[model samples]
Target: MKKKLIQYSDGYLNRVPILQFILVTLLFPLWGAAASLNEILITQFKVVFELSDFATAFVQSAFYGGYFLIAIPAATVIKKTSYRVAIIIGLLLYIIGCYLFFPASNMATYGMFLVAIFGIAIGLSFLETSANTYATMLGPKESATRRINLSQLFNPIGNIVGIILGKYFVFTDGASLESQLAGMTPAEAEVFSQEMLQRTLVPYQFILIILLVVLLMFLFVKFPKTKPETSKNVKNKVNLGETLKYLSKNNPFKKGILAQFIYMALQTTVWSFTIRLALEINPNINERFASNFMIYSFVAFFVGRLIANVLMTKFKPTFVLTIYGIIGVAALTYTAFVPNMTAVYGAIFVSVLFGPCWPTIYGRTLETVDDKYRETAGAILVMAIIGGAVGPVVQGFFSDMFGSLQLSFIIPMLFFLYLAIYFLSENKNDSHVKEESKIA
Candidate 1:
């Protein structure tokens, strides 16, 4: 029986259309790269615009705020058209957003940059809403979580690349901007700020060219028709009120949304402030040099995702998630209390713990949802990414209030604790359900 189960799993995997799967999986890294760049942007923008920590966090607020606003509309497009159509639309929006960077840089306007970031996020919202749900439907239901986890593995690769680009192409080598500004004439400062803003646009230029190529691929390449079992017909128009009413009572799905919200908050806060925390601990390093730690963190995140893929094949995803959550909470706790270079390393280690939570919670949440509701449900879940927007601002507020980046980490620690408890409860419920099934 064990051998037969293995064969069944293999057969389900084999049935997946490799080309379409590859194309959809490609999207994972693109968004990963985009998100990683945001962390870099927070630091860069802080220096460029002479903004406060709370003001810098508005970068995430604008970016993820786009996700919250566009998600439901993206879902509506999917229901009205097809996943292919929605994906193409998303790519178009992403391309347009990238182009906005040119005007933003030329004008040297921080608000324009925020507008550009918002556009890019809207595009990402569409891609995530389509790609995540589409990945689950690619093969058999039994392997859904594993398949999504496998695809998400590429996301960290994108993250690593984004950090590398920021470290190399974006960050300038010199005295800190604040120090330089204190001595410079206002005219010199304006010139220096414009130069810095132009440098920030370099990565986006590279991103725009790549997005154009990907957009072409999506436009011309014929995606395989979804199997009938997974396809929706025209009769199944979405009713927002009814969908919300149904989902309101779904305990697991609701918990998953909450988990995702808290997880995003934790993730954004940790990455957004890693450099700030590093500088606080050791004042000697430049922003460029400090970014090396962020790179290390992404590498750890990549490694963690690889490990998670293997673990989930043999163990339940919630069990793996619960374990990671506990470790994450412990690590953040140490980081908060220690306030040393060792604590910095501990904070970076939290990335490994975070690597798997997004996909695991996402897949598990959708598992409880009916197929008809999957697209809209996925949209609502993606909407929870607003936590990314909200978390950093709150952390920034705390950082400013207490004047301690270290103390602010307590916020994420609590968030991690919530995830650990959530998944532990889920694991118990899953076991209870299995035991009852056996008894019957």
Candidate 2:
């Protein structure tokens, strides 16, 4: 099975220009890192700005709000132009957003920082729409899910590194800096807070330089002008209204959208508040210590993705998704009720279960939709990432009201339950369609 999967990957790689493939794959981790940094931002901003839990979660709202607002526009851009142009546009916006952090810090306003994050997220929306849809076009239908999963393997790797970056530079240093200011006068503490806020500027500046280089690479790289897999009937002028009309008949695709919506919501809620849950449940854990645990969670997430990659070659992608979703529901349900260190570990375990859900569902959605509509479909699903914007704030509100971070996990538990149902229903509907076609 493993050999066959490798052969499939190699076959696709052989078909595409190797450098173009490599360049596209490089984007997997970049956006993953950018998204994962929000975890640290949630924790850091809460402390740095003295924000309430609800207010701090606005970071996610602003970040994913960009996705909500910009995904369709990005789709329109890709529809009118080419994926390469869209990728270059995404990279430029990402770089601009990263650079904006410097001015935001200098201004010492949280709202300014949110504007920066929003800009960065718009870039991510474009990249996801282009890259994910492009990945599906690289291989035959049978292996599309595995191909995306293989590319997505780097996402967790980048997440692990992002967590590490947050640990060493943002969370740890901020904690130490805060401790230093505890003994100082209010004036001195204010000065120290400004200095600490400035620490964020360095990492984003480095990110800006890296994105600029990637942008240049994309500018010069030659991507395949068309894929054999894309339907020749696909018009350059894709009509959004017509696409929606077609999609209304696509039952599996609709379910896939729901699953993606809930999946993203659960993912952002669990991760965005992990540090808060950790400190609340575990007496020995501080903010810095909990940040390390977040890294550990990503380690589990990476391992889960690796295992899922292997499992995809052996079993159906939907089967794997269903299994993971079931486990995730159980674990998150346990986490919500337990309210202890065990629950903390359970939350991490559930995160591992979520690792494969994103890529698998995305791959399956592309497979089910017509090639003509895949790009627009991808954008609509990325727009569903607004669930990330919505879920965290809801969870934050619950946590603030109830004063129990652990119990607030009920929000994500419900999300996982929705996913398990969607997965089963999608598979059942597919089987029914196949059976009816065979009879005909």
Candidate 3:
């Protein structure tokens, strides 16, 4: 069949970019299942199992934990297969993860819950690896920046729906604590708490069904073709050893990847503890309702990326990433020191600042690389994202023995301090105006 091509705003973005957009958009609901499911999962732990902030972060640790196990294997699969095949495999694993939650929740075993989440995250690992590569290959190679930005809409959109669903399910917010305290016995209050947390099933099952349907839909969808050169052609196309040599010598790229990895660790660590931190902020804060606030926190991420897309046209991507890294330092500081719900809420807005870091940091890293190695470079980038898994786990361990989840966030913040240095070096010696003009 002849492929239907649609042109994008940038001249290079023409030809079926819409298909990529549609596929990327699916990330919303997939991630939504993750984000939304998190609220109830964590809340139930805190109420039933009486978990600490450190212990609670384990929930996210379990999720990102899959990335570590699956990262390399998923990349190998992608290298061997087409993007569509990899994605299909990923979505299938995710559905299994979702269904696993049924038995976990039914058994009321925290271990089971973690196992299920790990399964889902494994699926996500494949999705992350494939979808990003697909997006990059979709349009004019020169217009890669524009295409990546446009594709990122899925990130925040999924987060938004995830927030809403997470909040709606976990937060049973009826009868203020004061009112309940005045009327009910201690035993009665505990029962109410149990009932409130169990309500998570309402949304978890709903999204799980949506994920199943979506997975089936993608199976039918005709994703555009993208293939890595195979066998004899592979040697002629690109050599992995040479690609590694090129990436290794690239100082800015090396530092940038390290910076990005650290930045993500810090970001994930703080966010994993966000729910507990919100409650710490307001004694009256509903643990169930905390997911709703998280929804608001994620808005900054969405809005920040959207704004960056517009401003990237005017500003250099590296400069933008550097500024965001610096702002990330400031936001982490604010989040660390502040005790108010409003301050924590404001701190989440930093996601906007951070929203551009991963992609832009990546773009800057590859700025020096020849485009032939882009696929290999992408696998390395996914490894960089694995820092998210590692960093959060470290923070969670701290939270486990320590009393403060907020304070644990500082550990990851240290990584961002290094990221600032990486950004600073990206455009040294040259005038900022000249750099922007050159890229423009």
TM-score winner: 1
Task: List the lowest-lDDT window of 10 residues for candidate 1.
Answer: 1-10
TM match of model 1 to true structure: 0.94
TM values, all candidates: 0.94, 0.90, 0.84
Model 3 agreement with the true structure over 1-30: per-residue lDDT tens digits: 655564332212345456556766676447
Q: Sorted on TM-score, highest at the top, how do the candidates line up?
A: 1, 2, 3
Model 2 pairs in collision:
none
TM-score of 3: 0.84
lDDT at 150, model 1: 86
Choose 2 or 3, whichever is better by TM-score: 2
Candidates' lDDT values, in order?
A: 0.86, 0.79, 0.68
Worst ten-residue run, lDDT, model 3? 7-16
46, model 3: CA deviation in Å? 2.7
- The deviation in Å at residue 140 for candidate 3 is 0.8
